[model samples]
Target: MNRDAAPWREDFRGGSREAEDRLFRAMAQAISPRPAARPDAAPVGTDRADRRLFHAKTAVGITDAALMVDRALPAGLVVGHFRPGAILPAAIRFSNASAIPQADGVPDMRGLAMRLAIPAGGPHDFVLANFPTALARNAEQFLALAMAAAGDWETRLARLASRIGLWESRRILAHLKASLKLCPSLAHEHFWSASPYLWGSRPVRFELRPVAGEPPPPILPAPGDNALRIEFASRIARRSVTYRLALQHYCDERRTPIEDAAVDWRPRAARPIEIATLVIPRQDISGREGRWALEQIDRLRFNPWNAPEDFRPLGSLNRLRRFFYAAGDQ
Candidate 1:
């Protein structure tokens, strides 16, 4: 932690206020650092799009979807864009979580980035992941991990051991290995916010689960790099895919700490209560209109900070996310 300033401390409640500046610099360097000169070609690194620090792989699909807020929900859960009986038009992008593009067979984190078109104001974004918890606890730990990853085998191992220790590193590795296995289809997998957000005045975590009665995705004899996309296309060609959007409210600081995103609050907190539904319509994204939609979506930036004031993101990790994401856009 840098611990050199205190002015921005008020914005980040229970956050790593000291590490924010250092984290910003580190993220900027990691994403698009000045490169060594080349003999004939342009500079080694200049393109921001090509140098995205994470989740830079091809999107599995960028299609239209709708979010229907439940009309029968209790009055308390109805806040922000989740107004009862509201039908919000949305666009969703499914992606593999890797700085470099890899095959679908590879066991890695997956992402579900969504943007809702709100009639009241600007689009609200939700960046969800297949994993229920983050690998790092805060911006400082994330910076250390990123630094360690840039080193060689021996140096990386030593740095990991020293920075996060052997047991914690091993635990993260095991968790990733078990949870990030090859997905039969993106539509079947659940997506979690993993971090907290302010639901009006209260903090809450959200997730999306596939609706019941959809047939299981086929077991490919040998899945290719686009296996997930292929499965989704085949299924959507026949019928629409739907999901239940639910939220788990915060309990207490000890059980559902706002600062630590690495902790899974599901164990101690109450089960998630359903509030809305998401439906991906049966349409061809492979055709001309679909291609146009994909191109437009790829050009758009989806950040969790693009939300209503009442639904602002919480925690140090999210605070770090807000800083870096906004910085990247600039």
Candidate 2:
């Protein structure tokens, strides 16, 4: 029994013995790799279909261009909507995802997690990563990947020996191996919902795509390389680019298999993508309003399980999150 690990009793808090065992088994299966004998499947493009579907279903007055906005919810802010036309204001925080204590200029995935107060729809919260798909599908898979990446002393020594042997044996000539490092700038990177969820009346996933243009120049680390931060600040100052929230729907089962996360959604089966523009205005992070917004988002809880009755998350990851997220909240 690893003392650092969570207890089995904790896992069974509100369940019977049978249920606990089943959960443990499911967790085990999620962490294990798929057998090599199983070949990978094809990708799917569902965003196009979702766009067409959403447009067709919306009321006559709701034009595709109407969804664009010039400002986002404020930092650590909450907004409530009482009536169809009524608007309530709130604050929010935008930062890098690496958890490294640094300005937004650091090369890493852009994390967009926010909490919004809706008078009618309950609290709205979301956490998005820069990539369209997550590195792992579920919590267990996440754990396994972390463990694999965290090589022990023996593993490190073995890798070193292999490199040395290769060099001595002349097996490789001038191998230009790039070191595994996080990116410094996130401006060009697009954030994604990662997990699939039902969007409005249709089942779909969401992704933030950058407008067509070159990102700011790269800023490598140096004695005083605060240039990345400067670039980020300048971009916010100019406010040139506006992101589009593209929704993709699943149409075909064969190409866009729901069970696998590695495969991209097939474009062939994809519905037209409905786009919603998001414009972020510059705000002082140290200001009282910004602090308030950060506090609100941090204290507030956001889960896919908190979604409307019709829009449930599907697949093994969703099922696992339903249990674990609830437990963590408790």
Residue pairs whose backbone atoms clash in candidate 1: none
For candidate 2, what is the lDDT? 0.41
RMSD of 2: 15.4
Least accurate stretch of 10 residues (summed lDDT) in model 2?
A: 53-62
Once fitted onto the true fold, the runs of candidate 1 whose alpha carbons sit more than 4 angstroms away are 1-49, 220-222
Q: Residue 89: error of model 2 in Å?
A: 6.2
Name the TM-score of candidate 2: 0.55
lDDT of 1 by residue, 1-330 (tens): 113211111234334555555555455456334522221222112123444457776555565799998998777777766778999998887888876788888877888888888888777889888989887776666766767766785777578778878887777667667676777778778899988888777788899898988888767423787777677777888899999998887776766767778888874464799988998999886678877876666656677877888888887777666655644421
Note the Cα lDDT for every prediction shown: 0.72, 0.41
Model 2, position 323, has a per-residue lDDT of 43
Q: 66 in model 2: Cα distance from truth in Å?
A: 13
Considering every candidate listed, which one attains the maximal lDDT?
1
